[model samples]
Target chain A: MNMKKEKQSGCGRSEDLVTYLYGEATPVESSDFERHLKACAECRDELTAFQSVRGTLRQWEMETVPPRIDIAIKPTFWQTVKELFAMTPVWGKLAFGGVGALALLALFNVSVTVGGGGVTFSAGWRPQPVQVVTPGTVPPVVNPVTPVTVRTTDEAAVRAIVAQLVRESEKRQAEQLDAKLVSLTSKLDNRQRAEFVKAVSQLKQDQRLHLASLIQENSRRGGPDLLDLIGQVQSASVEVEE
Target chain B: MQTLETTDMQLVEQTLGGEPDAFGVLVRRWERPIYSLAYRMIGSDEDARDVCQETFISAFRNLKSFRGESKFSSWLYRIAINCCHSRQRKQPQPDVSIDEQIEEYGLEPMDSRESVDDRLYRDQRAQLVRRALAALPHDMRQVIVMKEYEGLKFHEIAEVLGIPVSTVKTRLYTGLTYMRKRLEHVSDSL
Candidate 1:
């Protein structure tokens, strides 16, 4: 029990020593710990050991740093626009969209006509007069709202724009595809012509060899030519029949 | 633009004010200590560099939210420690070899007039210390590294680790005691 008590005292003293070494202990507590440290050899030894460990750790270092470039926050105009969109709340987006739609309807001169037969919706878009204001002007230019014409629905104009865009893209794609097809066709034509010429030359060479062999055979036999020989054989057969 | 006297908070402010290179100044300022902390924590040079870079990037991204409740360096330490925790979760800590440690950083000569045997002994002792440190539990190692290596105050360490000051003291005491025994054993083994 006495030894266990001493062990606890040693643990507590070491804890206090660490607190003192790190300068966390109060002045009074440090004084008391310092007095105790003078009396306690075990605590002093532990302190030395910890300091040694720290010295070893201090040896570990970052010798060199790999070069790295800092990424600059350079937002493009589109990126700024995107950031604005991202920061906007859902209600704000809806409000802006509603206002834009109302302005678009007003700009297009959209109208609804309720007649005896049925109700008809129509719109006709006309260019509105724009008040141009230069910088540093005393008063800004303001154009009064012009009277709107009751026209049909403006969906046709929007559809026309969309369709035109689609047609232009399709036309560009078709041009690219047609160019590729033409190149491929020319390549195929060249290859086929070369192959045809090669085949024709081969056939002509075979025919010349056959003719030459026939001439050689006729000369070796020392008899009439092939055609004459056949003619004579035909005549003799005819005579036999007669 | 930067000067040698620019503080981390000043660099952060400049970075927030549309000067991107200012953050690089902060990075250069704290890079070594941060890298050393990471290298000691994770025991891998590559991972330590990655953590150091990541810590700076995280600090940059979260700069707007910083309320200056703590020291800027302490905040960086917190972020770095958190990063080390995240890395620890993603991968197991591999046992670092003495050769690898030597290859990464050659042993420091303790004395100019030391003989070859003394140099070898010192090198072996350094390795023994590292191995003993690596053998410690994670919390103990963290406390030891922060308190001993980083020279952070107990309260500052508590702030970084989000623990109480008493717990910091307890951990430090426990870690030192454990390391003392381990070092004794390592000395005997060598």
Candidate 2:
């Protein structure tokens, strides 16, 4: 019975042997297990077999680790930017293109000065209306080279022209604003409200500066005062706020 | 040479600090153990290679999630073992193709410079050991591989497998017993 019991315990609890083999058993456990291993032929033989298996495993080397797979280093910042542009939505691309075209138009208008010649790209975005005399409207250019009898287009005509041009420009601007609104509202989480507020304030400041400069330029060019245009802009902003 | 001695955690910090090459250091250091574990678990060279690459890639991507809760190698082992499990599931069964079997046990002509007959004898012994191991259950195979080949401590194996150390010991003991029975002739010869 004593021999049977020892056999059962030895076979059932080889964890001590495993711990000792792996050098994990504590001092007492190690010494005790070492003594036991000296006497226990079965345990000693099993340890040897496990060791032999470990040796065999050492032989199974990865002949050559399929060439060090250097992770194609993550794209640089500019590459990430290029990827962002490439991934931008179609509406986003259109909005960017519209902004770019508007910037170019602003640069062109800033560069060219209206003189007493032909209409010189004065496609009516200027606050001061160019005195364009349509060939039919000019009453026959009697002097042939007398500057075609330049006359400021009537205020109603200019206002109508300006209103139409402003409407188209506003339409394009509204499309971009609508795109931005969709994007912003879709992402309207708690964190974005502060960003939205900052963005709006910055936009209003930019508009204030742009309109102030336009008012000054219009005054210098002997055009409409446009002081109420500022009020109109402020009131329109108030309407948006409401 | 300096990097060879750098600790895994120090390399990990370097990798996270934007020196991506540091990860390459970690890979070179750990690839052998990881590949050995994968090959022993799956019994296929190509699949093991796939698992090895995937393990490092995953570790790199999810490096931030590594909260230092365990040893870096244990964490890597966890990823690799998970990859093995996934690869096993995708296959109809873990079928060790003949080519992989030959490649897996094929002996190398290193410094020992054993004769052709000696190399063939060692190859046969290795093939027997691998077959015996492959016959064991997945849990038993993993515990044995980590403990025997990777030299992971019982607790480390437990941590890698997310089991109790007691369970690790039980599996290792049970697995060794199973391998002993299957490899009786080889064990007797040894």
Candidate 3:
């Protein structure tokens, strides 16, 4: 028991001396530790030995930097979609093929309507019969004359008239689309324009909201108050009128 | 635009706010001490680098859960120590040859005659020290490495290992006593 007590006391002294050597002791503790070390050769020698070991360990420095790591970034919607599509199996592509066929059929119906063709559509796979207008619904004839029955000549003339009508309708539709695109493009800044293109291509609702929020945030940060925005809009209106 | 004095907490907040590059500054600052701790604990440069990288990756992934209760460096050191322990548990014991151990101790046939005997004595002492260190249990070896090589305080080590301070001190004392006996044997051999 006495030997155990002596060993405990010696261990405590050694720990104190180690702390003191590392400059972690208080002033009073340092004084007591120094007094103990001055009398105890064993503690003093142990401290020196540990210090040498520490010095040698310090020599083993890592000569190279750790390897580089890739950081995770928030991927854009299109980027995620591309990744998903790339990993999609052949069966998935076939399922998408069915959806594409339905979409194409819908697009053809809309195009036929816009072109004012005599074609009628149904939900069936085959084309339905076209509708003909009643003779009473036609405009009244101003003059009574014998209708010319030039078979080949009349077919060529009808084809020419149909082609001209289709071209005019297409020109009108193109002009309207161009105007809408121009207006939308003019309202957006460069960054917003890029975001808008990305949102449309990716078909993501969140991206659209994000683009809108970014525009509002930029306008707020531009130091433009409500009065300034109104003034700018009013000036733009006046310039358009001029 | 804020010119406030940057603290680790602030850097951590910035990193949590999606500024990943901000954490790179922390990595650059603490990589050396963390690498040193790992290297001393595992005694392999390659594994130490792996530990450092793994530590940073884990710290980054879990930064939001830090809770600001402890110093960032202390948290990082704890992660590194845990990584080292897990690695030690997974790796099979290395087959260390006696000749390689002697060579690591700088013991070999000497060419010069004047200081040959003294060189042999020093080599034997080094070999004894290495053997004693290897003989220690993993826990005891870890405590010794942190205390001696990494210079962590007893309380800090306890915090890192989640053990009591007394346990840390006991392990250190036990490890050193073992080394002292081995050194005495080396002296007898000389």
Using DockQ as the measure, name the better of candidate 1 and candidate 3: 1
Candidate order, lDDT descending = 2, 1, 3
Give the runs in model 3 whose Cα sits over 4 Å from its true position.
A1-14, A38-45, A55-242, B1-5, B94-135, B180-190
How do the candidates rank by TM-score, highest first? 2, 1, 3
Which ten residues in a row are the worst by lDDT in model 2 chain A? Answer: A1-10
lDDT string, candidate 1, A127-193, tens digits? 4433433246664534346533322233344445566788999999999999999999999888766
**Residue pairs in steric clash, candidate 1?**
A122-A151, A122-A152, A122-A153, A123-A151, A123-A152, A123-A153
lDDT of 3 at B157: 83
A54, model 1: CA deviation in Å? Answer: 3.1
Ranking by DockQ: 2, 1, 3
Give the per-residue lDDT of model 2 (tens digit) for B1-190.
3455788899999877767778888998888788878887887888988999999999999999988879999999999999998998888454553235436643233223443576565665666667767756678889888887777888888999999998788777777666655555454554
Docking class of 3: incorrect
Q: What is each candidate's fraction of native interface contacts (fnat)?
A: 0.23, 0.24, 0.06
Query: What clash count goes with each model?
Result: 6, 0, 0
- Model 1: residues with Cα > 4 Å off, grouped in runs: A1-11, A23-27, A59-242, B1-4, B94-124, B185-190
Report iRMS (Å) of candidate 2. Answer: 6.7
* lDDT scores of the candidates, listed in order: 0.70, 0.71, 0.64
Across B90-173, the per-residue lDDT of candidate 3 in tens digits comes to 985554543445456543323335346864545444444545555556677777778776778878888878888767766665
Name the better of 2 and 3 by lDDT: 2
